[model samples]
Target: MGNKLFAAICYGENGKKILTVKCEPEFGIYLRENYSDITLGYYMNKVHWNSFDLNGNVPEMIIKDMIEQSINWY
Candidate 1:
């Protein structure tokens, strides 16, 4: 809801049951409402994927954190 990077999904280290971040072209970040669709954004394009390009300025740890966070959410 808030304009910030929130936890999208929570996955295990096993790589199973992956989590996802909702990258809406407008929202700029993921939100709880996105869960309703149950679809991980666009099918072909990663436009809606948990874009590690957050604002075009992201650190490697931040990106890793997003992935880890997603796993936890799952």
Candidate 2:
């Protein structure tokens, strides 16, 4: 299977997703088109999200930065 990069804003008892981060396929993911300019993430459904595939095309640091940006999607 192709490696897909996904992310989501996670929530807890506090009632808000404290942060966002890369998500394993099994865990589900979301997407938000307005999140970034170059990159795009979309809402998976109601609560989870995902990002565009890295496809091993960009450098590792860029991917890392994308993950970092996702983490700050709060």
Candidate 3:
């Protein structure tokens, strides 16, 4: 296997992890289904995590929203 490429980490109140989100799961899934640049989390629970290609076609607003959601969800 190779090294995982994660954009950010989401931690819980006690500093435990909630998920490693590349983008919000729903949007990530849509990107996965509709595009070739997004994928499920490299080493995380696929249902709740996703890995996005930052060099891909995703928008800045969406990326910001995803990061916010990741933090909010925790």
Candidate 4:
């Protein structure tokens, strides 16, 4: 990606895999509303980042889409 967007992966206190990605706050709002597992970025800025379970019920393709979309947000 040409943009310098920040992204990362880290484990939470519960030992679950978390994927953090940079994204538009508006889009993050949409995802948070539609996906039950999405949360305001874990230990990150809520408006610029989002974090979700790598193995949760949000579906595999959607997660992949999110990851791809995130890298392009900036």
Candidate 5:
């Protein structure tokens, strides 16, 4: 899967997830601000990466979009 997004589980923490898509920096900021579940990606560049709570308020569509965006990115 050239889908670079579905890389790996940042850790064994099944509740949170690392970003799979290379989205705009502005969008990443917005996501972290707008969603309580979103945050800077684990051990990654704060400006270019993001992480989210899989069981939080983030809508299913948003997660799907991230996956799709990652597919295109690779």
Candidate 6:
């Protein structure tokens, strides 16, 4: 068997997902313009999702705060 990957998803009252722990499009664009390791989310809505290279230049605290903000959106 092969390994599997899962995402931490946040859902709305309507049972629709508001955001995943992944990055958002607006932030992604800003990060990409300023950092080298930030990119659009794979297998996700490009206009609303983003992926981050944890080993890259972004600070850990910033990432944490971003995730928190996403959660608060729900």
lDDT to native, each model? 0.42, 0.41, 0.60, 0.84, 0.63, 0.54
Off by over 4 Å in 6: 1-24
- Kindly list the per-residue Cα lDDT of model 4 for residues 1-74, writing each as its tens digit: 76475678889978999889877778899989999998989989888889998887888877877888886665
Instruction: Report the lDDT tens digits of candidate 5 across residue range 2-71.
Output: 5255323465275454443455678777877888877777766667667766556888887776666545
Which of candidates 3 and 5 is the stronger one according to lDDT? 5
lDDT by residue (3-27, candidate 2, tens digit) is: 4434555443345332334433333
Candidates ranked by lDDT, best first?
A: 4, 5, 3, 6, 1, 2
**lDDT for each residue of candidate 6 in 1-74, tens digit (9 for 90 to 100):** 13422234444345543333445556767866776655565456666565555445667776676676555544
User: Whose lDDT is greatest here?
Assistant: 4
Q: What TM-score would each prediction reach against the true structure?
A: 0.30, 0.32, 0.57, 0.83, 0.68, 0.56
By TM-score, who's the top model here? 4
Q: What is the lDDT of residue 69 in candidate 5?
A: 56
Candidates 3 and 6, the one with greater lDDT: 3
Query: Candidates 2 and 6: which is better by lDDT?
Result: 6
The reply for model 3, stretches above 4 Å from the true place, is: 1-27
Model 5 scores what on Cα lDDT? 0.63
Note each model's CA RMSD in angstroms: 11.4, 13.6, 10.9, 1.9, 3.1, 11.6
Q: Between candidates 3 and 4, which one is better according to lDDT?
A: 4
Clash number by candidate, in order: 9, 11, 0, 0, 0, 0
Candidate closer to the true structure by TM-score (higher is better), 2 or 3: 3
Task: Report the CA-based lDDT of candidate 6 relative to the real structure.
Answer: 0.54
Error of 4 at 3 (Å): 9.3
| Global CA lDDT computed for model 1 | 0.42
Arranged by TM-score with the best first, the candidates are 4, 5, 3, 6, 2, 1
Taking all chains together, the TM-score of candidate 4 against the true structure is 0.83
